[model samples]
Target: MAPSSPPLPQFEEAKSTTSTVLWQLYHHRPRSPRAIALSVLTFFVLLYMLNTSSSQSEPNFWTKFPSQHPFPERPEDAQVALPQRNDITINDTLPHDLEKPNPQLHILLPAQRSSRGSCRTITSAMILGYPPPTLIGYGHEAHGTTDFEQMVGRMKRTLAYLEHSRTVKDRDIVLLVDSEDVFFQLPPQVLVTRFQNILRKNNKDLLRKYGVTTVNRPGPKTAPAVVQKYTQRVLFGASKKCHGAHATDPGCVSIPESSLPPDVYGWKTDIHPDGFLNRPRWLNPGTVIGQAADLRLIFKEALRIIEQRQKKNGDEEAFTQIYGRQEVVRELERRRTVSLFKEWGYKLLGISDATNISTINIRLETEHRYEYGIGVDFESELFFNQLLSADDVEWLKYSNVTKTSALQGSMGVPREHRLLLPTDVAALPNPFNYSLLALNQTTLPLWNKTLDKLPNPEDHTWNDIPLMTNAHSASVPVLAHVNGNTKLRNTWWEKMWFFPWARALLRRYVRASQGFDAAQSSLLGGADWWDMRGGRGGVWTDHESWVRFADVCQGQERDLFDDDLGPWGKENGDPDEPVYNEWGNLVYGKEPPQLPQPPQLNDINDHW
Candidate 1:
């Protein structure tokens, strides 16, 4: 229409070029505003959803599972159970074969010796007189008996049970004696043999003077007046009387009711003293010369004492005047010293040299005089159990050493009442012999192999010496290797420089959970505010200053860099002036320098 455009470029040619250009524009053009906005909105929505879901999830996901699932509820309880018994098997007949044939066995329960009774004084004399295998006493009377009868009784029972279960012959019988109430623990056969030997060894004159035609029995006439004096002294002491003889000057020894300690007149102290004065002096009846007859002797002696006391007093109430059955039992307990009995048994058995064995006092109130045994290694606990069960004896089981009873509250029933044989001694792992050898011989070689592959050998220098030098060298790329392979990365330089440094920082964070100290230095990249000038490149400061400055700039990077470039970056006044050369050499040496440019308004106000 405007001169027909001269069909200027020929419509077809123009159209072809236009189509090619249009095709390029279609692929290369910037996206539309609406499309860009939609993409950004979608991304934001996805990010928000991810954050919300993560926050909503349970913190302890594993615990949320059903109880029927077999996952361990507690970390400590997950340890695998250890083997109960060892592979070594022992024959039961071995103990019998080792023992001599038909050796007579004897169980001796010494007469009860009470703190307040005649037996008590006798026991003290015997203990003071003899060496090993000395006489000890135990009785049935409460106040006149040993102090630790329950403990001694349990030990006797334990030994007897063991011997009987082992099918040991009567001749092989071991003498079991109580310390306070009885004197000797020798079996009848052993006692007879020993007595014969003694008689042979003693001179005729000595035998006539000391030996008796018949075993002399102590009675009222034999009882020394000194014993009564001592008894009165004890009574006075218990009553807190600092002066006077108790029986000779009764009023002098008697304290006013208000002055007496609480329960001074109770059966425990006063009544027992009175019983000692009233009861007829009798011979130690539990003293017997027979095998397997200790308990029987004790019972007989107790009955004899009770009967004698009743007859001597000639009153129907004579028995009540001294003590009831409970008091008799207590008297027996007072004289019984289980430790002494155990020591005597050990001396007699010839098994005292074993280093790992220890005989402890086990108090069993339910049983009569029988109480001590060896503590075995924990590894032998099951074996001990097997032996005991086969022997027809009950084992006392305790939850722990501190508890008084075997069973626990609401947990479950205990196994049984038995002595504990801890295998902890035998099963203990030897760290010096085993664990050290493994670490030095095996693990160290593996670690060395990995170190050999590092690209930079200088980095290994830190591994061989102090860590600080290594950390300094590692800060420079040229001096230290940053290998991609983790095994290679674990070289000495990496470990000493990075790992320890990182670990220290992690520890700080962990400790922060408890409490934190603000004065500690940062472990991240070095500081920027402290004017550190000797770091990796000439661009940064020295290690110490950089570390310090980095700590100051802990959360504010932009502010730190801005401050450095502003007032902190200047020489005297203006930053544009070059006071020194690029090599850090002063251009004017000692001379004062002149400013190269006028101070800008921004430099004066904005920098400040």
Candidate 2:
């Protein structure tokens, strides 16, 4: 019909175009039916080939597994093995004989408190430690105490310990005194070497040449002068008896009475018994020397004198009088006899008329009052002041101030100040002026009451704490000095009590906090949270922590931070954030978190 209306030409053309486009789109867009079918067939072939290769490479499970069989046994052969020992003996005598000579000097100190002042006298012909004639102190104790026996005992123990530890030999003996005033600061080793050289040649000759002095002149008489000369000769070793060869042998040689020379006996001169040349106030007991054989004789004679004194007086009286004037005189006599021993010949020296060795006059005066024992003055304050100067004082003050504000702080006060004003300034005992109004009134028991109130073992943690330990586990010696007057009591308390307590407190605090470990805290970022939390809560906190906490509590950190990091992070904007936090915690977060806002500039301005 009209060629089917020409199939509505536009519609028919549109339909045909749509069908062709659909067919092309279907064919180009992924896989069509033919492609999919080929893909499936290819996948199947690949899988089959893979399965076949695997089967070919792998062992069959149905086949029996191979078993490992034991090898044929071989005949055993027996053999004997015996233990052997090659004995060898070593002889100690050969090594002992080959030991090298020890040259370390052994100094023996035997201090005794005497009436003059604390003194140290050198006995070695060879000067050691410090030279003879060295003026070390004026008239004060080396240590505060004047108990000579106690000093000697301590010195003996110290020396014994030193000797054992240092491996010192027995022959190199040198005796020292604790008396600071007695030791002269000179080239001691030089003097010692000179003395040793002289002794090596002719000990008596050197002593006679060096020992002569104008003091202690002999009376102008034949027999007395002869005896005096003989005494001087024996004492100074101007005579031959001082030599080791004849020291023990009294029958070796004798000075004929007729042949005694005038100068040999005594020379007329003024006696200046003020300095070292004169007898010292205190003498070291160990300086007294005698031959091995003569030691027993001297001991016997000393015992005889002691016995005589005991017989005359009761036991207590005899004991008390042992170190008295009579005993001193007997000791002098016994010393003379000991001097006769060949071994002691070195002690005697020839008196020299040329050298005028001047003795130093020490004038010690206290502006406040005579406090403790006069001997204590040397080591207490007077001597220290003499030795120290204005520059030293200033240096010490600056050092202490600087140290106290440092990270570690100061360790108590300077040693000199501790020795001087030992007690607290507020606790200082009132100075007493001898009241003419109440001169006869019994002094109020102020000193005793004050001492009773003073700090003791029960008052501090270090009261019974031991400062040292030895092989025997003995505690370090504790000493105390009690004075008869107010001044003495004050000095003793200050030096012995207050200073030591202060030092102990500092030391104990330091030792206790030194081993603190900050890593034990279980916090994010492994922070030192104790510091951030104001250093409180646990018992494991250290001194630095407490100091930090105290500073923070006192609002010191605001002042510090205000000057250092400024006040930008005081409020808002994540105070724990790395950029904002002044104390350096980055990951700190509160459990119930709040939204963070930008920091306000006004906050910093307010701080300013």
Candidate 3:
């Protein structure tokens, strides 16, 4: 047997193969049972460590900030890690890029309004006004007085901050809106998606004019997701009607008419009236959205125009005069004409027309709620037409021709004060009298069902928001802008606590922050008062659900109507102290001891 084995194994190939196998095993792996087990254990241990490392799995900054202040959720939370400056930036703590841009969709708000009382209430209203406030919190707030930075300056500064932000990529869309008076009901993603749909349904031919040789190159992309991917650089909110024959269609939106000359909207304000332009299309400074780099170009050009022409015309109106000129130049590019804003350092990356944006809606009101009372300063003539349609709320929003403090419609509210509130609340009040607003027709809603699935549904927060829609389509509105006085008491929205859908959203907010007690003093946050940090604050992100189980406002020792920390003290004792009225409602003072003056001291009759 030994002689036969030796003859078989003597072959050179067999000998070499055995030697190679033994060499590899000896050098690359342990052959012992204990050593092999230990090697397997060591491999698993390293992998476990890597999987749990801070880089792989991290906590939500939304809930992390309150427990630990000042520090970021991660070292790289701020894109560039620049030191914060309160005087120049939004706050002394947050960096320009506090959030990571998964893809794109940047919301920017400029609040130069006074950081005062009812403004705080209105601000809170705007924040809570969104069906799910969570869809919004990731926006920006541009602060400081407007006196130093005119409208143009404010917009430019904010654009500059965004342009340089790490969160912004070349393709990201930057949407500029007035935070004070505006309520965002849909996710920013939906806004962009709708904007794209409007273009496909209306601006296809218009892009051809801008040298898009292919014009929807791949041809027909009807899917919402597909259209959103190809949307243009700029999308302006429609202030004037763009459709002639197809105005009321549900899915098709008529953007600013493509048949008209480029000189009809935005910066091109010089064309003679009449024709398509006769109707006067405008890019209301109210909202403007575009690519980050493109937006930077816009703001930069606007600032240069302001610096060049500030002496000729006030800095405030300069931006309005030159707002849409970039569109004009793009038109010139289409026509192969000379450019004014300079085509250098800029590429025509999908710059396009004003599209009528779509929003979402939920029909909740069934009984048609109404209010009327004596000496009630919070009077609202807010009534909706077409009672069964969800668009009734939109009729209320688009119908308003009255301006908020943004345009100086009130006595003491310096438009900036309405914009400057510490919590960005100043930007939400509509100084324009709600009673005088010219309510409009129904605007389309969006596709997102964010409001459909209520948050913390197991709890009682449903009072704040209820089942608004059984079928959410284009006919409803997702947000409501309460442009009236809510400071004296929870005015317009307070009663919605029992609205057909959900009312607890606002009432719960007041109860949580003791906003009712603080209502007498929300403008000036008191010693124990918590600042929402302008809707972006920790209170909303961390404790909004606290109202479900606990009376969050219980321990606070805030005094109602305290002058130093109050909106108005007992000065002149005319407006009475915060007192319960005949209907068990809180009021400014009882009937004035002195005969009520006609205007300022006038008595109001509002019924609920």
Candidate 4:
């Protein structure tokens, strides 16, 4: 204690420093505990607000491809070994291998007699060089169908052909597709393999035992994988919900005109080739493939439903099973009724009997898990009205749902046969998974150059596969659906303003196709649709069909035949006169998008 004093130098130094710190803290504006807590909370709140705003401003899938799964870039030098000049195809521009046929498969298309918009569909098949379709509903005037009667007409004829005719055996694949919109990306063998994979059956042994050319049935009681995976002999898929008039209230069976803009709801008049149609929530029957025997039953059921609906509704044509007529929906709207589905018909009182349906929905395929990306329908984000999330591409299938009490259960679709509503779209009721579109999200993977597991166009360069040189995994949607505002949304414009690549893609396909003058900048003019249809707009190649089919893909289906492109071929400020290199398009410009150096397509490699 004797001077614990006067302390040491180290002690003095520490004391001085401590004093300085205390002086600063004492002089500095000190806050209460509550004030400090509030300040900290405020900083966090500001940070959260900033994050929310930035996320909200991000562009949706409509404009940009998802970062996780971007579009695939085209292979620079993939060459295909296409056959020599053969059958005429789309744009009357493509050369097909019709002379050399794939005898193992039977591709069926119900075409009109040079009347269904310039025979572009048939020409597409011919250009692809697949064998001619059985040709159902030819020569007859198109009375028009509500739910794919053209296909139904062909199905009936095909079934008849299969029932008694010895030509179609169990081994033969019978593919029914939308003639014009879809292009044959690969050969029949490839398609058969895809079908077998979807079927999820052990048909390799049976296939090898019978040989690819000849198909024999397994012994009685032994079900074929074709019948198993392609259950009920049908295949299709569902797309995102379109925010048309019907979406005002998905749970409501009918929406009134008052709930929608005139252009947003069902058209008051029959503006399309087929009138009074009811679109299914799921199951776009654009392209369906199956064995002949099983396919016959699916067609038969569809026909029966059509007949029953026709008889009860008092319409000679227009065959839609579950989806009711425009009048029916309107009447419900007037009544302000709210139900999962609309009634069959006011004229007929009782609920219709349940019918059988064999659908192949890519949207719900358990095997693929419904991966996200564009298919034929490019407006999925718009339809869903939301941006992508981790769970966006969940597995959806018929086994997912339980019951359908209304005509959404038309023909009283059997509980087992009916497409079960996917949980994502079921808020609207009766949402099934049907993506049978030509370029569905599932099917497009075959052409996606981005996926490592799938075969790249470059790997098979100078091989047999018909390479879609213009195919951009991220840029180009598989189906390239001709969709957009079209006077419905603020984004609608005079130009096509749809799947931007539609015209280029179709034109590229025609160029990539064999036989047509590969060198001709603008060989000739197409007869219908947008520009390709000889009217106005920038449609080229078989894009005429692309625009034509857009109407059918509508939500409420306001108009199935709408033409805003002035007069076809005139919308682009060109007089109906065909001119090459107009600006820079292959048709308008002198040079193509740098000759997509894809070689002649032969057959694909053993790679998936």
Question: What TM-score, over all chains together, does every model reach?
Answer: 0.15, 0.20, 0.34, 0.30
Candidate 2 shows a clash count of 28
lDDT of 1 by residue, 38-127 (tens): 999999886655434231332311112111111112111111112222222333222221211222222232333222122221222221
Q: Candidate 4: which stretches are off by over 4 Å? A: 1-103, 115-118, 142-155, 164-166, 183-189, 201-233, 241-281, 311-608
After TM-score superposition, the amount by which residue 376's alpha carbon in candidate 2 deviates from its true location, in angstroms, is 30
- For residues 551-585, write the lDDT of model 4, one tens digit per residue: 22222111211333232222245333333332533
lDDT of 3: 0.32
Taking all chains together, the TM-score of candidate 4 against the true structure is: 0.30
RMSD of 4: 27.4
Candidate 4 at 7: error in angstroms?
A: 60
Candidate 2, superposed: residue stretches over 4 Å from native: 1-100, 110-168, 201-267, 270-608
Residue-wise C-alpha lDDT for candidate 3, range 256-373, written one tens digit per residue: 3333233322343324342222222333344555556555654664566567654433332333433322232233233232121222212344353423334312121222211000
Task: Give the C-alpha miss distance for residue 46 in model 2, angstroms.
Answer: 99
lDDT of 1: 0.25
Candidate 3 segments exceeding 4 Å error: 1-101, 112-153, 187-189, 210-231, 240-280, 311-324, 330-608
Using lDDT as the yardstick, the better of models 1 and 2 is 1
